[model samples]
Target chain A: MRTTLCDRLGIEYPVFGFTPSEHVAAAISRAGGLGVLGCVRFNDPEELDRVLDWMDDNTGGRPYGVDVVMPAAVPAEGSAGDLGELIPAEHRAFVERTLAELGVPELPDGAAERGGVLGWLHSVARSHVDVALNHRIALIANALGSPPVDVIERAHAHDVPVAALAGRVDHAMRHVDNGVDLVVSQGYEAGGHTGEIASMVLLPEIVDAVGERAPVLAAGGIGSGRQAAAALALGASGVWMGSFWLATEEYRRGMAEASAMQDALVAARSADTVRTRIYTGKPARLLRTRWTEAWSAPDAPAPLPMPLQNLLVAEAHQRISAAGDPSVVSMPVGQIVGRMDRVRPVADIMGELVADFASTVDRLGTLR
Target chain B: MRTTLCDRLGIEYPVFGFTPSEHVAAAISRAGGLGVLGCVRFNDPEELDRVLDWMDDNTGGRPYGVDVVMPAAVPAEGSAGDLGELIPAEHRAFVERTLAELGVPELPDGAAERGGVLGWLHSVARSHVDVALNHRIALIANALGSPPVDVIERAHAHDVPVAALAGRVDHAMRHVDNGVDLVVSQGYEAGGHTGEIASMVLLPEIVDAVGERAPVLAAGGIGSGRQAAAALALGASGVWMGSFWLATEEYRRGMAEASAMQDALVAARSADTVRTRIYTGKPARLLRTRWTEAWSAPDAPAPLPMPLQNLLVAEAHQRISAAGDPSVVSMPVGQIVGRMDRVRPVADIMGELVADFASTVDRLGTLR
Candidate 1:
């Protein structure tokens, strides 16, 4: 299952696993794939630095990466406290009322006060890049397309390749023009913020559009080795998977206290998610729950744009998580959630993917 | 490049082409694939019979199929005039106003009035089946899952197989239990009426669910041979393509007067379509134009349920097509429209698909 991506990234398999948990990322790296730690959950730079230090010690000398979220045009820099004032009261009230109606209690006193909007701000994302480059990170990825030109140059200067997620050909071309080394063509069926193009079309489109400029990694709707083979068949250099890892044993171990999210994910079908702007103030695929359904009501206030929307719901999300109710939790997942019916160790999942890819390829060979 | 579907259908390749034009259907059959002619456009049973006769004569003894639309539960039978009175006045006015705003002129005097809702009704669909069975049709497909049990029995009596389009595992399972011989796993990215799951996920899911009961034909987001290869990798027996054929030379020749639709399609990108209910009262993907965008406005009337909505806008559709303006033409297309950049002969498209599929398989074998 090796491609040029494996040679370029020095990984045994051409698989890139994106996760918010440092433990899962390290496990993926140890399992012969690139483990990309998502940095958007870190409000403080020091927390990310601590996680990277742990990752460096735990990866067993394997290569891993870090992902940061930054909008194309930098928004006005503001602290989490200052950004709280920008959220409309109506939107805030709707969130608060919905949470209370769902019976989600407030977080316990002094529970680390997470869910701040600072992590989404440009300033914090830049700080993430700075901290990631300081560590032995093999790659740096920007979720919302190419980072600023200086950021790309800084990564290149540090001898680390920079990858950007694009949902359209124009975006992929623009990322390459901005000096990105790779393009992760994320599709509409993916978790988190996504564009309207599905991976089946978006991948080949971006691969053809960014021909010879940057390697394209297929993302979204990929859960197994057969899907990975399909990605290569569509002209991708490798496969980038995020949702499939949420059901991994490492993920369950890393977030042991939050079993509700795992329970919800395990019980979900492909049709159980909805695409809405209620998450992160941008269109993202999220598990369809009572919380998301409330926002769909006719009178519900329109979700604010990114950072503000995330700020408004961050506390609500915390409460929903704290409530320990799987039916009302707010989480981002792709359509591949249907196949994540059970938990498996990261190593087992990687082994199964490789074996499946091999057998699928062999089966396809017979047709030829 | 053949699966069990090829042996069962007695076709050379496992490609099932869904098209409305008899000329295109005949070309696909003669070119070695099964061309399923869409019959919903024929409100008159005799018109469909005539087309089947034409297909029988042109297909050169090759196999072809017919597609009909009959909802799960039959609606009350009504004449086109009787159904016309059931459409709300405001809905009628909105369509008229939008047509006028778009400068779509009314049809010329003495032109045949075709956009009747009868084709969508159960009686008309049943008549289509009766008429198709009287011809040399090789298959009968229901766009909205399995047709009536009697319809399935009727097709079997003639030694013709029945195929159904399914979007979910449950739907596919039900189709098999209802005696369907093949299940077309149509995904969210498909043209016309579709389910929310994308083909990348839906294909494997349906294959797993249907097991050995029925062969699944992967549909949606498939335009080229590489995609067809991906479908086979995902466990599908064949590929069912609808939108890719819209750019074929046979289609252009058949609908020569409507070059505007072809022009709009050629200029479109994968992102040029929007999934909405304005077109058919049920959600369907259509080319994003002023017509669809107008319905998205805050004050636009909620699209009436199927049959009613189609009745309300049938004349508007006639006017829009009559006006010969590509900018406002309403057409059903999949995300694959981006790849339909030029018109080519049907045989050429079929040849490329076979060659592409073989090459893709050979390329995948190298990875193994």
Candidate 2:
């Protein structure tokens, strides 16, 4: 499924997979698709550097990208240590109360806090971009909004294309105005931070608005070959998938937490997901576990803003994960989780996606 | 441009246009698409009969359908006259106060009381079905949910196909289980009543769930040939559009109120719409006009449930329409309204759709 985007990115197909696992990223690149490693989990720059180094060594010289959360607007301004002060005592109390009520056990000693407010701060994301650039990364994608102009220019200087995720047409226009190389039009059904617009509506709008300026990647609820074909038909240069890879063997092999999350995901349907700001201040689609439901209670405290919310829930998430309770473990997923009933290898998934896309195209070709 | 759905319904194109105007419906049928006349506006059975007769006379042997709003769950249970008593006086006062604040003049004498709560009740909708069955209607579609088992059986007894609108996979499965011949998977992007799931995610899920049992018609955000092609590629049998025709010449010709609405729609962008429960107590996507904004104000009262909300706002809507105040007129529209930049003939729109679909398919065929 070659397109202009595929040729420009030096990939055989325009299927871009976003995951946090270096194994999944390398596997996707080796299978002829672009696997973008999400850098939000790498709180330590050295760890990020190690991950990128590992990717370079394992990708067999194929190209891959790095994704970082650098939202245009930062809710708080402080160092990682000072950021904790921004979280209100009420939010902390609420999180503690909810976790206790859910029977979630505390994390063991030295389990490591999973996602503190530090990772979401601009300073950390900038560090991630710097580490990513030190490697042979071909693309840099901002998960929240358009990357800062300086960051875009820096990526450009390094001959790396900068892509940004947009949930609306105006967002896509802003990215184009900032000279973004590509825009990932994510729909409300996407796993992470997303806007209210659906992919079907958002994709064509972004494509029409910025197709001349940059190629658009369709994201949200795209897990299969037919959906990828539909995305391309909707004028997207490629399909940017995240949740589809959550069920891959590579993903499970990299993260021990995947066992509980994958078990919940396998049994979950489309309706089992909800868009909640309980995780972060920004609304993100995640599996509707007890952790999410506790926050959704009628009397639950309103989530704190951005970095504060992330801080308030960081310890609770760590505790729940360490407890290995599938019911309370919150996992970022899309409606496509309904289709992920079993685990498969990245190569098999890629083979099926390409084959399905070709067959769907052939079917449409017979439509006249 | 043709499919089994078109052949089964004896139409030239698989496009199904849902409109409240007989003129627009007939024009769509004459233009080789099935125009389903929305029967919710017909408060009286005799009026619906008259409109169907008008459609039969104007369609020139072309196929057409009828759409009725028969929700699966009726929030209010009572006759039309008695249901008015169920509407709280506070809601009535809010509607009146909002209308006065917007400077919407009172309805002129003999304004015909356009839509009483009577039209929305289950009994009224069933009567609409009875009236529609007598006409040469090619299909009967439930707007709010899957039609009752008896309704489906009744339509089947007459050898007529029964279709229903679904916003999720389970809804589509329920419709298929109830023997619906077709399911219109209405996404969140569509105008009127819609579920929270976006079309991109919802369509493919419904298609995969019930594609073998019944053909799925994709609804929501489909205003052009490219979207239609994408829907077809996603496994939808056909494209069902409602908002796209709102800007058509025939629509304006049928309703004098379309002038201001068309102007507002033309100037509106994708974000200039909101899903609100103020109109019918059901969350429906409408152009973000002053009317919707007034209800969204912090001090505004919570909208009553279903028939109560419809009853309270019915007179207000009539007064606003008669006053021709563009700002206060709440028009049901989808994100696709952004694409409706001009008033054109149905035939011209159909031509563009067919041409765009062919070119889109050709473009996809070359993606290798």
Best-performing candidate as measured by DockQ: 1
Q: Name the regions of candidate 1 deviating beyond 4 angstroms.
A: none
Tens-place lDDT per residue, model 2, A1-368, is 88998779899999999998999999999999999999988888999999899999999899999999998986566865687777778878888888889998777777766547476888899999999989999999999988899999999999999999999988889999998999999988899788888787788889988857899999998988888888998999999999989898998775787788778888888888899887888899999898888888898988888887777787887787777777987888998888888889999999999999999999998885
What digit string (tens of lDDT, one per residue) describes model 1 on residues B61-156? 999999999988776678878888888888888888888887888889998777555678998999999999999888899998889999999899
List TM-scores of chain B, every candidate: 0.98, 0.97
* DockQ metric, candidate 1: 0.83
Model 1: CAPRI class: high
Interface RMSD of 2: 1.2
Q: List the residue pairs that clash in candidate 2.
A: none
Q: Weakest 10 consecutive residues, lDDT, candidate 1 chain B?
A: B249-258
Model 1 scores a TM of 0.98
